[model samples]
Target: EFYTQPVQSSVTQLGADIYTGDNCALNTGSGKREVVVPVKFQFEFATLPKVALNFDQIDCTDATNQTRIGVQPRNITTKGFDCVFYTWNENKVYSLRADYIPTAE
Candidate 1:
């Protein structure tokens, strides 16, 4: 027996651009102890994507005496965004490894 039938289906594609290998230093000064790490995407996205970050490794100057560290994303765009690494007191961040992933829906 031979039969012909058309199958109806829909496919949705999701994309996520990942950018890593950001090993920078954060030398915080007085007043506000924070560092703005600007990130530029390799390729521009069609729409504004959600930026997600993960601080894999962080090395501070002081090991024992160090304040709480905080991070935030600002000025997000289709091209890039900035990751702000801050601390309460004057604790200089020697180096840090941050990985960013931008996803579009």
Candidate 2:
């Protein structure tokens, strides 16, 4: 599953922000499933800022045996970033609660 949310500036750090909320993806197969959730920012920066995934706060449910969840940032742009969620099981649902950290150019 893949989705996006509106950017909220009031809930962000000075240079960082949370562009998405509660984005979830489900793995219905027995192998690793990867889903890419797109996040939009308020403004386009001059350079690509550093992006990070808050994996510690992730909420996963209905996971199979030996299921593992992983997250990462990819295809980053000046305007937004992609939060990639990975799961290693069938019928596993991974919820994302990611944060973006902007770096000084």
Runs of candidate 1 with Cα error greater than 4 angstroms are: 1-31, 61-67
Candidate 1 per-residue lDDT over residues 26-80, each given as its tens digit: 4546335666768777778777878767676676665558556666678988788
Give the local distance difference test score of model 2.
0.60
Writing each residue's lDDT as its tens digit, candidate 2 over 1-105 gives 989997644223232333224544453555677777777767777766776556546555653345477768788887877778777756455455455554435
What TM-score do all the candidates reach, one by one?
0.62, 0.61
Candidate 1, residue 48: lDDT: 80
Q: What is the lDDT of residue 87 in candidate 1?
A: 63
> Candidate 1 clashing pairs?
none
Compare the candidates by TM-score and give the number of the best one.
1
Let me know the TM-score candidate 1 reaches against the reference structure: 0.62
